[model samples]
Structures are given as C-alpha cells and as structure tokens.
Target: MQDLIAHAPVLFPLLLALGASAGFLAGLLGIGGGIVLVPGLYFLFKTLGYAEASLMHLAVGTSLAIIIPTGISSARAHYRKGAVRMDIVKMVGPGILLGVAAGTVIADHLSGAALTIVFAGALLLFAAMMQIPPKVRDEGHAMTPVKGSAGGFVIGGLSSLMGIGGATLNVPFMTLNGVPIHQAVGSSSALGPVIALPGTIGFILIGLGVPGLPPFSLGYINLLAVCVIAPLSVVAAPYGAALAHSVSVKTLRRVFSAFIIIVAVKMIWEASHG
Candidate 1:
C-alpha cells in the first residue's frame, strides 16, 4: 500500500487528465468516457508493471467505478433538457442489471489479450455505427418493449465487459429506432451506473483472494483510479452535457464519427503492439 501511495503523484495527474478528457467528450458526443478511460487505463496499468493478463480487466472494472458519478451527472443534465424517457429507463434498467452480472462472469474467465481484442472490435463497430446512414423516419417514438429488452441486454453485456456505459451503442441504436438523437444521448448517459453497479459487485466477488493484484485494488476495480477520477468526472460531465446542446446535429455526428475512428485506430494499434 505504501508503494502504491508512493506512486500517487504519477497516477493522480493522469486520473485528472482522464477525467477532463472524459468530461469534454461526454459533453461533445453525449457518450460516457468509458470508451476513453478503459483502454487508456489498460496501458497505464501495463506500464505500472501489473500482470499483463489482468490489466485490461482491471481497467474495465475501474473505469466502471469512475463512471458511476459521471453518468449520474450527465443523466441529470440531460433530464433537465427533457431528453430522458422515463419509460425506457424503467424498462431497460433491470435487463441491464441482469446482463451486467452475466458479463462480469465472462470477464473473469477471459484472457487479457482476448478482452483487448474484443474491445478493439467493439470500438470498430462503434465507428461503423457512427458512420452509417441515419435510419429514423420519425423522431418521437420509442422501440417496442421486446426491442428495448434485447437492446438492454446487449448494452449491458458490452458495458460490463468493456467498462463502457453503452452510450456509443445506445445513442446510435436509439436514433436508428426513431428516438431523437438528443434524447438518445441523454438517456444513454444514465446507463453508466446501471452497468457499473452489478458489474462492480461481480468483479469484487471474482477478484477476492486473488494474488499479485495491484495495490489499492478491490477485486478488479482500482480504488486509486476510481477515487482520483470520479469527482472531477462528475464536475466535468455537466459541462459536457451543456456543450452537447450547443453543437449542430450534423456537426455533432461528424465529430462523433471522427472521434470513434481515431480511438478505434489507437486501440487496434495498442492491441496489436501489446
């Protein structure tokens, strides 16, 4: 623990940067910072000399911990904009909880490289989704309950494994299914804690009694990272939400596509090299 504390100076600055970056992106894209934070933490952990095999899992779990607050902050910001659908949140929330639990089990068994590859693939898929043509013919209706349930499971599973809040997937999916993009992004913001709560519990149970884990660890979740990042993330998230309101939708879509592409390329490079 002393050794970990000794490293605090190094980690704290990085966490602060991560929080700011996430906040800006969350505001800009209506997506949580998980996509940014998880992969970035993977490399940070690897550099810190933790076991390569556990690094990505730790990153994912810790990202979830940090995202808990950011998501809530962003969600509230969107709620104030009248973008959230209570009906959708009510219907999807339980399915997400169940799926997150299942995904945590899968994460526990997967290899680090396998997880990275999967993450890389997910990023690529997000990039593709962002680039695709819009499919919405109407902008005021929600999908059927069955579609919502299925989407919830997918979002929950991916979020649990990748440490994402599913905003990347959710926003695009909702837009395609006829929800307005603003509302989609807003509602998607709330998913972070929904995914995090069950996933964090699962990681704790799985990581208990493990040997050679990093200091300040809680199962796969890292307290050092979470504590360092969460507060700033909360503060910055509303700023990002406000920014979301300022951008034109076309400009926002272009920015979102470009951002995912850049991130996807970075992930592919890291996965290939690491």
Candidate 2:
C-alpha cells in the first residue's frame, strides 16, 4: 500500500491515459481496449517493480478486472446509437461463455514469452484485418445459430487467451459479414462479460497453488488497480461513444492502429529482455 501510494502520482495519470485511450478506440473502432490494455499493463507492472514470473499474470488479471466496467460503459454508448444486435448477442452468449473458460485455462499454462507472442500475433493480425476493407454481403440479415455459436467460440477463446473482451475480433467479423458498425460495437460490448467472467475465474483457480505470487493478488487479478481504474473507465466509455458520433473514425482507426503497434513492441521487448 505504501509503495502504491508513493507511485500514485505516476500511476493515476497512466491509468487515466489508458482509460481515455481505451474509450476513444472503443467508440471509434468497436474494440474492447484489451489490445492496448494488456501490453500497457505488462509494461506498467514491470515499472512498478513486480517480479518477472508474476508480472504478466498480474497484468492480464488486472486488465480483465478493468474490462468489467469498461465493457458495460462502452456497450451502453454504442447501444444508444442503435448499433447493438441483441438477438445476435443472445445467440452467441452460450458458446462464448464456454470458450472463455477453455481459453483461460490454456493461457494459465503458457509462459510469458508465449503470451507475448500471442499478443504480438493478434496485433499484427488486427492491423492486417483493418487494412483489408470489408465487403458487406448483400444477402439476408439473419445469422444462423450455428454460425453465431462458432463465432462466439472464436471470440471467447481469442479474448480469454489474449486477455481482451473480444471487441477487436468481433467488430471486423460483423462488418465483413454485413452487420452494421453500431450493432457490432454494442453486441461486442456485451461479449466482454462472457470473456472476462470465465477468464478471471480461470486465472484465480490456476494461481491458487502457485507460490510467490504478488502481494494482494487474487490468482492473477489485482483488486486494488481494478477497484481504482474501472469506475472512471465505465464513465469515460459512454462519453467516448457519444462523442464518436461526431468524430472521424477513419482517422481514429489509423492512429489507434499505430498506438497498438507501439504497445505490441513494448510487450515483445519486455518478454525478451525481462
């Protein structure tokens, strides 16, 4: 607590910046901020002097905690724009829940290098995905239950493994398949819980028997950071969504992509060096 207090001056601003960046990207691109948050937390925790072995877990867990609130706030913001597809969300929820559990278990076993490699791959893939323009299908609007479930599985697994809320993966899939941006964002927002709930639980279960875990850590999740950062993020998320209506998303996407690239680099650096 004393160490955290002394670092508050630096950590608070860092958290705010992270929250703001997350909101902006969520509003602009329909992503859940995990792409940025995970890598950022990795570096931040390292800076805070956490041990190497426990550092990535803390980063992943803490990232999940913050997503709990950020997801809700961002979802509401996009929902108000009538972009959410509730039916689609409902159809996919079951598969997503199960997949997240599976993914978390897989992640719990991987080393930090493996995790960093996965994150880097995701970032690169996302960058490529953005560049490839979506070609909306001219077919029927309704998606099949089987298809939705399959999509949910992918979203949940990737999100849990990467410690994301599946937004980054969700939005492009929807847009490419003919779903509108607003609906994609709203629906993806709801998916966060499906990912976070099981993922967080998985981390806890895995971390329980491990020795030398960080102080005040629950499995991998850090309650202190989550409690402090999530509230503001929740509030900020809606504001970002509302503001998105007026902003230029094209510009936002380009800048956001570059920002993600930087984070990827940092994570890779740490995984190799520390």
Candidate 3:
C-alpha cells in the first residue's frame, strides 16, 4: 500500500489516460476496451516490477473489472440510438455464460507467458479478419445463424481467456453473418457485460488466496486500477458511440484493424523476449 501510494502521481495519470482511450474505442468500435486495456495494464505492471508469474493474470483481471461499467455506458449509448440487437444478446447469453466459466478456468491455470501469447494470437487473427472487407448480402438478408450454442460458447470462452469484452470477435462474427455493421457494433457493446461480469467474478474467485498480487487487490482484480479507470471510461464511452454513428464503416474497420495489428505485434514481440 505504501509503495502504491508513493507511485500514485505516475500511476493515476496513466490509468486515467488509459480509461479515456479505452472508453472511446469501446463506444466507437463496439469493443469492451480489453484489447487496449490488457496490454496497457500488463506493461504498467511489468514496469512496476510485479512478479512475472502474476502480472498477466492481474492485468487481465483488472481489465475485466474495469469493463463492467465501461460496457454498460457504451451499451446504453448504442441502445439509445436503436442500434443494439437485443435478440442476438438473448440468443447468445446462455452460451456466453457457459463459455466464460470455462474460459476463466482455463485462464486461471495458464502461466502468464502462455496467457500473453494467447492474447497476442487472438488479436492477430482479429486484426487480419478486420482488414478483409465483409461481403455485402441482399438488403434485410443475413447468413443463416450457425446451429446450436457452439458459436456463442466459443466467442464467450475466447473472450474470457483474452480478458476482452468479446467485441473484437462478436462484431466481426455478426457482420459476417449479414447483420448491419452498426447493429453488429451496437450488439457487441451490449455483449461486453455478459462477458465481463461473470468473467470478473470467476477471476476473483480463482485468484483468491493466490500469492504475488499487487496491493489493493481482490483476488486477481486490482481495486485501485478499477477505481481509477472505470469512471473515466464510462464518461468517455458515449463520445465513442457518437463517433461510431458518424463514421463510415469502412473507415472504422481500417482504423481498428491497424490499431489491433500494431498492438498484437508488440505483445507478441514482448512475450517472445520476456
């Protein structure tokens, strides 16, 4: 606690900046801001000389904790615009819950290096998919939904493991299935809490009694980081949603693709070297 207090000046500003950036991206892209938050938190903790064994877990946990409010704020903004598809949320909710539970278990057992690699790999795949333009289908027509709960389960599980809000995968999946881009983004924003809430609880439970956590931590979730980041992110989310409504879909895809690629590459390199 004393050490954290001593570093408050530096950490608080960084957390604020992170929250702002993450919230904007979440609203703008229908993402939960985990793609940005996980890596940022990892770097910050690493620099602070946190133990190698727990750093990535802490980062992932803290990111999910922050996403709860951030997701709500972004989802509400999109909902107000009539962009969210509650039907899809309802369809996938059960599968997402199961998958998140499975993912949290997987994450808890994995080493920090393994988890980092998984995050990087998933980001790389998402970035690649984003770079490809979605095929346009007949107006009001969408691809047949994949049968069963498998798709939702996979999405939810992958999201939990990566400590993301599932937007990176969900947006693309919905868009590819013939959902309108805006609707896809909006629905994905709504999915954030579905992924974060259970995932956060899982992490906290799994990490309880574990060693090497930073100060002010509850299980793997860092209270200090959550407190610092969540409010700023919530405040900034609406602006991003407004931007999403204003921007061209093509432009948003291109921008998000580029951003994810860079982050993915950086994480991959760091994992390899570390």
Candidate 4:
C-alpha cells in the first residue's frame, strides 16, 4: 500500500488518461470500455511488478469496477436519445445475472495465462465478426426481444470471465438479429452496467483472502485504479455518446475492429511468451 501511495502521482495521471480514452470509446462504440481497460490495467500492474499469476485477475476486476459508472453514464445518454430497447433489456437481464454468477466461478478457477488466452481469442472472434457484412451476418431468423435468453447467458458468462461489459458480444448479437445498428449500440451501452456490477462483485468475493494482490485491492479489484479511472470515464462517456448519435460509425467500427485485433494479438503473444 505504501508503495502504491508513493507512486500515486505518476499512476493516477496515467489512469486518468486511460479513463478518458476508454470513456470516449465506450460511448462511441457501446463497448463499455472494458476491452481497453483490461489490457491497460494489465500493463500498469505489470509495470508495478504485480505477480503474473494474479495480474490478469486484478486487471479484469478493476476494469469491471470502473465500467459501472461509465456504463450508466453512456446508457443514460443513449436513453435520453430514445435509442435503448427496454424490451431487450427485460428479456436478457435475468439470464445475464445468472450467467455472470457462473462466469465468476469459472474465472476463479482459471490461471491468469489461461484467462488471457481466452480473452484474446474471444476478442479475435468478435473482431472477425465485426468485419463481416451485415447482410451476410444476418442470414438467420430475425431477432425478437424474447429470443435473446440463451445469447444473453452466453454473453454474460463470457463477459464476466473476460471482465468486460458484454458489449462486444451484445452489440453484434443485436445487430445480427435485426436491430438497427445505432439502436443496438445504444442498447449495448445499457447492458454494460448490467454485466459489470455483478462481475465486479463476483471478482471481489472470489478473490477474498487470496494472496499476492497489490495495494488498495479488495479481493481482485483494485480500489486505487477504480478511484482514478471511474470519475474520468463517467465524465467523458457522455461526450462519446453524443458523438455516437451525431456521427457515422461504419468507418469507426472497422477501425475499432482493427484495434481490437491488434490488442488480441498482443495479449496472445504475451500469454504465449510468459
């Protein structure tokens, strides 16, 4: 704790910068910023010399912690614009809650390297899907609000394990199921908090009394990171949401997909080398 406190000046600023960028992306992409936050936290923790065994867990937990406020902020912005689909939220909420519980248990058992590999692989898959044309992607039956239970469970579970807000999966699912792309993005913003809150709590509970956590940590969640990141992310999220409403995002999606792929490859390399 002393060491972290002593380095607060340096770390806090970095976290704030990371939060700013994450918030913008979350709002813009409806991604809840977890995809960025997890990798950023991992790098920060690694620099601080946290044990490799627990580094990924801490990163994921902390990412989810920060996502709570950011998600709410982004969601509210979208809701104000009448972009969120409440019917979809209602249909998926219960299953997501259950899946989050299951995912936490799964995360608790996995090694950090294993978790990183899984996260990386999932990112790659999502990125690939993002590259597909919408017409080709939506060849199956049209999406109905009530038909999302199974997908919600799977997304929620995988999101919990990856310490994400479930946007990566949720957005694609919605879009492929006949939801308008913009509406899908908005709805995904709302889902972020749903996945994150339970996921954050689960990580905390799962890591309780576990060893090798860094300073200011509550179980696997890093309080310091959350404190530094959440406020900034919340403040910036609205701006991103505004941008999402104002801008054409087709180009942005492709760019973001490329970025995700790069991040995934980097994670895979790190996992393989480590």
Q: lDDT for each of the candidates?
A: 0.77, 0.73, 0.83, 0.84
Give, for candidate 3, the lowest lDDT window spanning 10 residues.
Answer: 139-148
* Cα-based TM-score, every candidate: 0.86, 0.86, 0.87, 0.88
The clash numbers for all candidates, in the given order, read 1, 3, 0, 0
- State which candidate has the highest lDDT: 4
Q: Which residue pairs clash in candidate 4?
A: none
Residue 30 shift from truth in candidate 2, angstroms = 3.7
Tally clashing residue pairs in candidate 2. Answer: 3
Between candidates 1 and 3, name the one with more favorable TM-score: 3
Stretches off by above 4 angstroms in model 4 are 28-30, 133-146, 238-256
lDDT of 2 at 224: 66
On TM-score, the leading prediction is 4
**lDDT at residue 30 of model 4 (Cα atoms):** 57
The candidate with the higher lDDT, 1 or 2, is 1
Candidate 4 whole-model C-alpha lDDT, 0 to 1 = 0.84
**Residue 190 error, candidate 4, Å:** 2.3
